[model samples]
Target: MSYYDVDAILTDAEKVPCQFELDVPYLGHLDNSAGLKPGTALSLPLWLAEMLALASAGEDARAPLTLNLPACLSEAVAAALKADPRAVALRDQSAHLYGVGVRMLDLFDERELGAVLRRTWAVRAADVGLHARKADEAVGGQGAEFLRGLEEWERALFRRGHEGVRRAREWMDRVKRS
Candidate 1:
């Protein structure tokens, strides 16, 4: 994720499940308590969680916290995508679902999760391309529902596909006139 990418910034702000592995006396605000106790589960922004989860205390000490897959990339969502990628409303899950998934993949080694994410992206990208090509006609129809569900990555893909189609049509018109 690039430092200047708006989507990346937003993804970093997405909350993920985390559990404190060590007591933190002054960090209770994270869980609305007096202090964070060991084993205290909390929802923390990806940025903070990543740092805490990776910070080493000593040669033999565990990291301060453990990170869990965010709800957007949970098993239920994966199963839904596996069942029907098109039917899922990705934006509802998280506007930066793919971004969070990518970060989680970097920290974890779940090959099945990675494969499911790849398949979902491939299926949805093709659908986005199709919708982009027919954007004008699909604006007020059922396609609108699908279009509204696209996450940031798919939305970018749709814009590029739409622009390519429009440019191709313009070129074709000029050639015909010539």
Candidate 2:
């Protein structure tokens, strides 16, 4: 098994290699040896780390600041979301991760907006690694419930327009008014 930390949490070893199979040959005969090693577990993908690193910063490019993602696992941000858009669709419709995604949109500047968040249905490519790591922590426990909520969360944000994105629009509107 392999492990890494993201969003201030340690993810399971299995998720390190993007993903793996858990199907048991028989009902309970699952094999564990097939899991990846720490060596193969990926470091945070560069673009994503930079995204997180950038959002975590203050007004200065290099200032260390503290903030939190409203929800850490938007299906769009999910590493495997592209792999399973249907499942992601469900989660987006029912989870609060949507609200988080909305908030995250606020943190973006013209740079990330042009680079991420506009492709694959408001999904960002740079976020895949961190989201993949988060999926490992969520397969069981509150993960399922959190996702359940995420389905609704995303729905609300999309229906109403993401908070951050809306703020961006409002800011632009104000500038136009001025």
Candidate 3:
């Protein structure tokens, strides 16, 4: 089994265009869906997966999948990294030593990045004993490093000179806290 499945990304993006389009289906069913749920059929962002899981529990069948999933996911992954002081200390180290596939998006295309991230997720997921390993052996470290780096970048955007991203993060944080 390939460590990661491109079908995961495709399913997530295809069903919920840009996060905002993800609305509960009629009578709690996913209309226009291929019968895929967040955890089972797709590898959605962790936060999103949790959110859906929560919303699915309540009778309120109309929860909006926050449109800022990419940024939010980027932040969550960063938070996980920061939770461990050792990983936090790794901020700004070598690229491969840190968030390998994600931050490297600037160096490649969406398709390429997706492929790499899938394989990376697979490998790291396996390394950590979650799922199977992503087939592609990354040049440097595991795929989780990229997620950590993305989160770190998101954190720095708050503490760094990027006032807009910082403000946006603050507002989003407020909403999440509420």
Candidate 4:
């Protein structure tokens, strides 16, 4: 995927903010340190809110943050997945769900949202008489196809990014070896 695709996915996933009210004074840490006072209203990223909700729930006493999931989430997911299984891009769908889920990992029960997306897509695909494909294969297939279709400069950017990551891994390994 191009940088634009990644950017779009992030932007879309973060568009909905999770709403919550702090019941206790929050000193705040790096990820969520906003110096929120008691009874203060805080609107944060869905992931962050979910995390805070999970954290507060672990405590024995009354929870500190009252977290509310977006009212439209279920509807939105259903509409998108059920509308057009073939028209929808599985990679983008997976990426969007992953971004949302990563932020709100603690909120999930038995099945994560990514798994839900996979299941939803599978159902839709089956309904449309499509063949079953592994989620990894679908995502990788898109990237491979995109790479093959990219222009010279785009291909170069992808290669440079790959090489940078490889070098970074090697450097970390060398440091560890010392």
Identify the leading candidate in terms of lDDT: 1
Instruction: Give the 10-residue window scoring lowest on summed lDDT in candidate 3.
Output: 127-136
Q: Residue by residue across 31-105, what tens digits does model 1's lDDT show?
A: 689999999999999999999999997899899999999999999999999999988999999999999999999
Off by over 4 Å in 2: 1-64, 68-71, 74-77, 89-94, 109-150, 153-178
Better of 2 and 3 by TM-score: 2
Where is model 4 more than 4 Å wrong at Cα? 1-16, 24-42, 57-59, 70-72, 88-95, 102-106, 109-116, 120-178
Question: Candidate 3: where are CA atoms >4 Å away?
Answer: 1-34, 37-41, 57-84, 87-178
Is 1 or 2 the stronger prediction by lDDT?
Answer: 1
lDDT of 2 by residue, 85-114 (tens): 334444433233333344345554333333
Could you tell which candidate, 1 or 4, scores higher by TM-score?
1
Ranking by lDDT: 1, 4, 3, 2
How well does candidate 3 match the true structure in TM-score terms? 0.20
* RMSD per model, one decimal: 1.1, 17.6, 19.2, 12.7
Pairs that clash in candidate 3:
3-133, 3-134, 78-151, 99-145, 99-146, 100-146, 122-134, 123-134
Query: Candidate 4, residues 137-156: lDDT per residue as tens digits?
Result: 34366555544433232334
Separately for all candidates shown, the number of backbone clashes (residues 3 or more apart, or on different chains) is: 0, 15, 8, 2
lDDT of 3 by residue, 18-127 (tens): 23334334413333564433322333444354355446445855544432223322444445444542333233432222233343343335553355345444434333
Clashes of 3: 8
Q: Please tell me which predicted candidate would have the highest TM-score against the true structure.
A: 1
lDDT of each: 0.93, 0.37, 0.39, 0.48
